[model samples]
Target: MKIERIEEYDERFEKDIIDQHGAYVINDETYAFQVLDRDTCRVTFSNRNDLNEAIEEYRFFGGHISCFVDQNGKILKEYDKVSFFDMKLEDIYVSQFYVSEEKIKRLLPYVKEFLIPVAKIDGKMVSLDGHTRMKIAQLKGISHVNCYYEEAGDYAKDFMEEAQQRGIFHVYDMPLLSKEEYEEKWHRFCDDFFEQRKAL
Candidate 1:
């Protein structure tokens, strides 16, 4: 959809989520959102046991909650991170601004989720937001991610351009891996992580 402002995008996101998972309240002064697909995600309320239990049930029943589940059927609490190489960063935003090292350092401690906003660019999924989050993830060397994406509507390009002009968005012309390549990389990364864990 065409998002003129961040608030508008957030509103649309909340509405779409509520439509799918019903309504819920946030707890712990934090919001936990689960990505459903390319266009929808739901927020998991914090203190509301009913809502949390419902989500746990959905996740237990093979729902795509985008978080890790242990063998005991419990969600592992960790910061949501994604591989920088798995993301598409070309022609999605406008500016090519540099990320501040200090900003990344400060945000790393409290990063519960790296909320990547993705949209279609020439039939390929490209990042529409979350440059800072992605950079932080890359720096921290983590896998798995908590991200959200929406399919671009007719006015997507115009909206992106407008946002870029307003300094609200930036674009990257980074090289993207093919699907096969990405899969190979993902497996390699996982293997490396496990190997390192074993060594430790």
Candidate 2:
């Protein structure tokens, strides 16, 4: 339900192993969850389909998620900051039209974990943040990416509606722009939108 720890990247030190708590593992490595219960169970994910079941278990695990570990205690992926599960890229809708090419390139190297943020809005999965990172993963031909749900406020619906009107339904519809153009366009648009809201 929340993030409490990010397992070290390939450290596997003797002091790091939580030998008693339940964790979600891929190839027998612990990726998430290290709670108070020593009797907690470990879930292995050999198939991507098992992710959903593991998520459900995480919701009820009675502890925060500890994402980062492989079956052999090697770190497979590290988000460093967020607790997220795997989600198909196609299921997430995007709100931005332009992603900075430079930013995308900088983030591409960190695509191994669920770093992009998404949220369920009106029963649909909407990209809450990290559009550039999501775009990078999509361009990398990655089918599944790591994502965490974000809690949105009342202003979110307005943002989604505006993006919808602009024909930005998915990440594919977004175009990568140079940093200068991205700032001039996207930043200007956000400023204008916020100003309009202030007037209201």
Candidate 3:
């Protein structure tokens, strides 16, 4: 099935989401929306066709993204979050040293966008965020995740350089630490860097 993203919205569709409550009468039976930062208001499919034994309940909340199908189409109950990797493991660098087992377990069950970018200082790609997800991906034996280049801040170069100095060149290089160990080691190091920056 092809997913066509609606780039433009009509008046009623805009009013239904923006005006707090525009009633479901304005929808086209397959329209669904999840407003960001507005939990109370939800615009869903207007066509209530054959609910008897076909479908019982629809989730009131959506994931990070919103999906709406076309006429004769239906909402997808779940989505496959793809992690398309291009660069090899050797091409990527890790910014952090330790990963918390607790945090990894907590996040592994959820859908996440695994993004990486090139470091401005050294011209090498490093993970600014989603370090845990990267590690998890590595543990799962998947090579080459997604890359969103040039999105790193200036401090990212420093973090990557520090990780490089510590021999952490890839996600697999970083070791798993207990929550306490992670806080004491990784968090302290990050905190110290920010504090030094503040002093400067």
The lDDT values for all models are 0.44, 0.59, 0.55
Could you tell me every candidate's TM-score relative to the true structure?
A: 0.33, 0.57, 0.55
Candidate 1, which segments miss by more than 4 Å at Cα?
Answer: 1-46, 49-65, 68-103, 109-115, 121-126, 135-158, 164-200
TM-score rank order: 2, 3, 1
lDDT of 1 by residue, 33-63 (tens): 4453422344444444444444444333222
> Model 3: per-residue lDDT, tens digit, 146-175?
664444667877888788799887888889
Q: Rank the candidates by lDDT, best first.
A: 2, 3, 1
Top lDDT hit:
2
Clashing pairs in 1: 27-46, 81-144
Off by over 4 Å in 2: 1-83
Q: Whole-model lDDT for model 1 versus the true structure?
A: 0.44
